[model samples]
Target: MLILHRRVQLLQMTLVDCTREKFSKYEQLLNDAGQKPEFWDVVVITARDDSQKSIFDYQISLKKQRHEVPSFVKYIVISDPPGVKVGSGGSTLHCLEYLANNFGQHSLSQWKVLIIHAGGFSQRFPSQSVLGKVFLTLPCSKYPIQMLEALLMMYISIPGKMNYGVFIAASDVIFLFNEKGNWDFRVPGFVAIAHPASLKLAKNHGVFILEDMISPWGKYRSDPSSPAMVATPKCFLHKQTAEVLKHKDSYLPTVPI
Candidate 1:
C-alpha cells in the first residue's frame, strides 16, 4: 500500500480561458508562468466558437515573437458553446469532461494536472503600475476560481485518490515558478481555494444552485418569481443535469466547497 501510494500522482492542469475571438494575447500569461522547452506539454482547450485553424495562426504568430516553436503547447477544442455564448458553466464543463475522459486513460491516470485560467483576469490589457491594484481589487468569492472549485468538486470523479488543483488570479496576477512554487502534482484534495479571507465577505456563503419550478420541460409561467427561481436539485444542477434527471421525481443535487 505504501509503495502504491508513493507511486500515485495527481494531474497538474492549466485550463486557459480561450473563449475570446483573439488568442494571441493569451500566450503572455503562459510566458510569465515560466513556460520553457523543458516544461511539460500544455493542452489549450478551446470552445466550439474557436476555430483550430485560427488558433494555429495565433500560435504561429506568437512563436515568431518568442523565436521558437511551442512544442509543449497542445490544443483541445470543445464542441460546447462557452458560457459567454450559450449557457453558463457549459464551456467550462466541456473542458473538464475533456480532461477527465482523455487524461484519465491508462498510464496517464498517474499524473496530476494543474488548471490555470489564462482569462481569469478582469481585463485583457492591464498596465504594469495598476497590475498590483487590479489583483487586490477583484473579489475572491466572485473570482472564477470559485466556479472552478465548485465545478471540479461537483463533477470529475477520479479513479484513485489522485487530486487536482487550479491557479486562479484576477488582472495583474502573476505566477512565478521557483523553489517554493513548482509544477509538481500534489495529493488529491482542496490544495487552496484562492484567498481565504474572501469567503467571510460573501453574502450567501453557501452554494448557488438553479431551481426548476416548472415541470415537464414546459415554457415559463406567467409569474416570474415561481419556485423555479430558487428551488434547485428539484430544477437541475445544469442544463446537462436536466437531460439525465428528467424523471420528474429524480433530483440531482450538487455540493459546493
Candidate 2:
C-alpha cells in the first residue's frame, strides 16, 4: 500500500489530472523560466542511522555530481541523530523539519519536490472484518495515498498558490535516467519507503542506490476540472498505533500494513 501526506490549506487545488497533463506543465514551467533553462534545489534526506563507513563516500559521490547534479539539485543528509536507530520514523520527522527550515523560503514558483530514500515502503495490507475484507488500494482521488501528490502539483503549478508537498519514492527504485528528463507525476503509484536507512546505488548491495534527482516543480499545466481540493490531513494509524508498533512512527499516522 502507498500513502502520501498533504494539507489542503497549503495549496489552492483543482480537480485531479493525469500524467500527460502534468508533463505538459513541466514543459511550460521551463518555458516560463525567463528564457534560460531553469533549475530548483534538490534535497536528499539520507537515512543513515547505521554507523557505516561509506556515508562519507556517499556525500563525495553526490558532490562529484555537483557538475551534473543539475543546477536545481541540492543533496542533503538527514543522518540519524547520534545513536538513533534506523527505521525509527525519527528520520521522517527530521526530514520534514529540515525541508521546512531550508527550502521553506525558496521562490518555489517553478519547482517540484522529490524524496528518494533507501527504504522499503510500509506495507499496510488491511485484514478481514465485518465488512468482509478491507482492500488496501490508495485513493487517487480523495484517497489516502495520492493526496500529497495532488497537493505538490498544486503548489508548484501555481507558486505562492500552495503551501507544502512531499513525494517519497521507495529506496529500491533504481532511478533510471533519460537525458530527456521526463517525469510523470501520479501520486499513490509508487511504494512508500518503509525503513529510514539510506544506501547509495553505487555500492551494489541488495540495498537500493538512488541515482537521479527529479525536478520538484512545473509538472502540471492544464487547469484541473475539479474545484480546489480540500486538504484531508487525516491521521492514518489507530489510537494505539505507537503502542502496537515498537518503532516511532512518522510524526503523523501511518496506515497499518
Candidate 3:
C-alpha cells in the first residue's frame, strides 16, 4: 500500500481550470514581472503554541486526519515551547531540520515548497476594499491545513528547476511533521460549504510579489469567487523578500539527508 500510494498522482487534471481561475490575479502580477505563472506542489504551515494557549490540539487533530488531506498538501507545526512529538524532534526549528534531511533525498528539481508562519503580518494598502488588514495569519484564516496550498501561492511560486524555496519574514517560522496525518486522502469536485484545508488546489504559487519593490499605492485584488483568499494583497511587496529562499542555504543549521 505504501509503494502503490506513492505512485498515485496527488492532483487531478480537471482542477486546472479552477486553479487557474482562482490565481488569475497573481498570474497577472507574474506576467508584469515576466515570470512563469505556476503553482507550488508542497506547503509547510508553521504553527506555535503559548503556555496559556496551545496549538498542539490542532496539531494532534491534523495527525489524526492526515490521510484525509490530499497527498500534495503537507502540514507542519512549530511550537514556541514545542508541543507533542509526532515523528520529528521538538520545536519548529527541529521539524524543519528533519524535513530537510528526509525530503533532501528526493529530487525537488521540479518541485516548489512554500513556508508560511502561523501568525501572518499586517500591512496597509489604499483601496476601496479592506485596508490595514492582516493577511495570511492564522487568526484571519483559522483553517491551517486547508490554507496550505493557497497561502503559499499568495506569497510566491517555486521555480521548476529548484527543489526548495521559502517565503519567510525576518522572524518567520519553519516547521515539519514527523508522522503523516490519519485521515484518508481524496479530492472533491465542488462544495457550497466546506473547509479550506480540504481543497485539492487553490491558486498558482509562482507569481507572488511580482513587483520588485513595495509600491506606494495599488489595488489590493482579491478573488470575488474565493471567499477564503484572505492573503490577497496587491501593488505592494513586503519590506523583506528573497528571490530563491532555500533551507540548507538559509540561516538554519543544514540538516543533511
lDDT of 3 at 254: 27
Compose the digit string of candidate 1's lDDT tens values, residues 93-202.
Answer: 55566666877643134333333332322344454222222212223322222222222222122212233233222223332111111223244433322111122233
Tens-digit lDDT string for candidate 3 (1-257): 56434322222222344444435544353345344345455545444334212443354355446532233344444433444533212333554564667677352333455444443222232331121111222422224433332444334322332334433421222121111122211122211111121011212122222222112111111111222211222222222223232211211122111
lDDT by residue (tens digit), candidate 2, 1-257 = 12112322122232223333553554455345355332224444444443321453364354345431223445555555565355536666666666667667452323444554432223442231111111122353332422222322332333222233445544433221111222233333332221212222212222221221111111111211222221222223323333332342222123221
CA lDDT, candidate 3, residue 214 = 19
Clash number for candidate 3: 18
Please identify which of the two predictions, 1 or 2, would achieve the higher lDDT against the true structure. 2
Candidate 3's displacement at residue 152, Å, is 3.8
Residue 256's lDDT within candidate 3 is 16
RMSD of each: 17.2, 17.2, 19.9
Q: List candidate 1 stretches off by more than 4 Å.
A: 1-38, 45-48, 51-57, 68-70, 75-90, 100-104, 107-185, 196-257
How high is each candidate's TM-score? 0.33, 0.33, 0.30
Q: Whole-model lDDT for model 1 versus the true structure? A: 0.32
**Per-residue lDDT for 105 in model 2?**
45
Model 3 regions more than 4 Å off: 1-21, 24-38, 50-71, 80-95, 102-111, 119-150, 153-163, 169-257
